[model samples]
Target: MLRVCFTAEDLLRVRFADEPAPMVELMLAVATLQRSEAVFGLWRRRMGRALTRSAGPLLELVPATGKGPLFLDPPIPGFDAGLEHVLSTPTALVRSELHRVHARDRAPSPWTRLLADRDRDSWQNLEHALRTAHTHIVAAPWERIRAGFDAERAWRTHLLAGQGIHAMLTGLAPTARWRETTLEFDSTDDVEVSLDGTGITVLPSVYWTGRPLVGRYAQGWFLVYPAVTPLPDIDDPTSTDTLAMLLGRTRATILEQLLRPRTGSDLVRDLGLAKSSVSEHTKALRAARLITAQRDGKAIWHSCTPLGLELLACLPESRGKPA
Candidate 1:
């Protein structure tokens, strides 16, 4: 278990990410591809076609398990930054982080030795790998990815406002729980981190939805975890049915709930629908092209397509009236 100890002042200074970090997403995307976790099997399969030679070098950075190198200093470096900032990361910092990882992991490899030698080629190769991965994996679906980031931010904001910081931290993941002054995580490593009044930056990632990544970063300290919502995917087989066939209060309510991106679990809690029922309804809505689903980690995030929003806009004010 991982424990994050906080001072009284730290409690007042907690912050949420304003947006997703492109480099962070790229790293997690590479890790996910390497493992081919069942949750992201579909994404991996789709992205396989886009993989390039650059991806090979970066895969060495992420081990099959354990904390990978903190290449992006300040774990959550870019708040609302772009891809250019990531590519522009100083070579010196990249070399330093790789050395740290090599020292800790003690996993000897030609790539590690090259990076340790401060080989400019190795640094350039890492950057190129990130760039290539971003273009192929994240750039195309960025709109949906950003939406998931926004949704997670909003949800945390709500938790902060309604129940306070403790709620926000513990609610971050099912495994995260608070007990008195220490926040504990169901982690693979037995570690303890003290905030020491530095406060923590809580960043969200669409690609990493499993465990909370806790570390001391340049931006004070941080916890980078999967966003509450998943990146949006629009891959269900389209059907020839018209929206009118499924128009009703229930379907309309589902569309309304999707004004912002949400997940099957979110809908289950809000609408009090059975898991199977929610899944079936979403499938129908997706087939009608009124909603699109993006699978992130294990959760499938749902958002209304333009057509779905347009249909909602045309609906009458009556609660149960069909559009």
Candidate 2:
């Protein structure tokens, strides 16, 4: 298991990422594209077309199983900034990190060894691989990705407010546990990292769904894990017309209950709906930008957005009281 040792001061300094780390996310997205899940099916096609001209470099770094070179996932904002970070890394460091990746993975070609040497032509090709992948997988869909990040941040903030830092840390992942100062997540690697008051940057990711990446980073220590969004792939079926009927009332009631941030468990109990049904309704509302969800442990806390509040105000049935 991965263990994070936190000092009292370190606990006080737990930080949330204000923005998406594009490079880190790009690496993770490439990993997801390697799988054949329906959600990633479209991207897989695009990736094949986009990277056909030059493929092995990025793939070699981002293996199907374990993580890629740590240098690739720099905690920098914007894609260009991440590229800049990689560009600025000492050539020796790049070679060393890639060598470690080669030890664990089997994606390297004879040409990729130039990357270990930081050869000029090899560096350009690697950058080309990154650009192609980003264009195909991350560009057009960035808004959805950004929204997910915002929702996760809001969720983590809510948890911090109600339960404080310790609860927030241990509650980050379902299996994560806090024992005194060390936070543990189930893993086979048995890695331990100490945070000697440098604190951590808790980064939520849209594509990474594996063990939490607990590592010593430029930001002292870092934790990047999959966002706990409610069925991120499920879209709401209640169309605008359908929402005008009984379905509208259900959504209206959901909006009302959400005025004060509420957990999924609260909604299941209050709305008297099956978990699957509630997920359907909330997923729809979220897609409409009428409501937003933040993770509070495994249960996500849903709350109405400004647009939802305006809509709720106009609905005569919902105007009077909180549901």
Residue 289 miss distance in model 2 (angstroms): 23
Clashing residue pairs in candidate 1 are 74-218, 233-293, 233-294
Listed per model in order, the count of residue pairs whose N, CA or C atoms clash below 3 Å is: 3, 0
For each candidate in the order shown, give its overall lDDT on alpha carbons: 0.67, 0.71
lDDT for 151 in candidate 2 is 53
What tens-digit string does per-residue lDDT give for candidate 2 at 269-297? 98788887688778757754668899967
Winning model by lDDT: 2
lDDT per residue (tens digit) for residues 1-323 in model 1: 98999899999889887776677777777677766445477787777656746567766776544367765423443423544454465668767777777777656588767776767897688667766777877777776666556545755675587668986788666667788989998877798998889898898776765678887755568788765334423111121112222233355567889989999999989898889868866875774456999999999999998756765554334234322
Q: Provide C-alpha RMSD values for all models, in order.
A: 9.7, 8.6
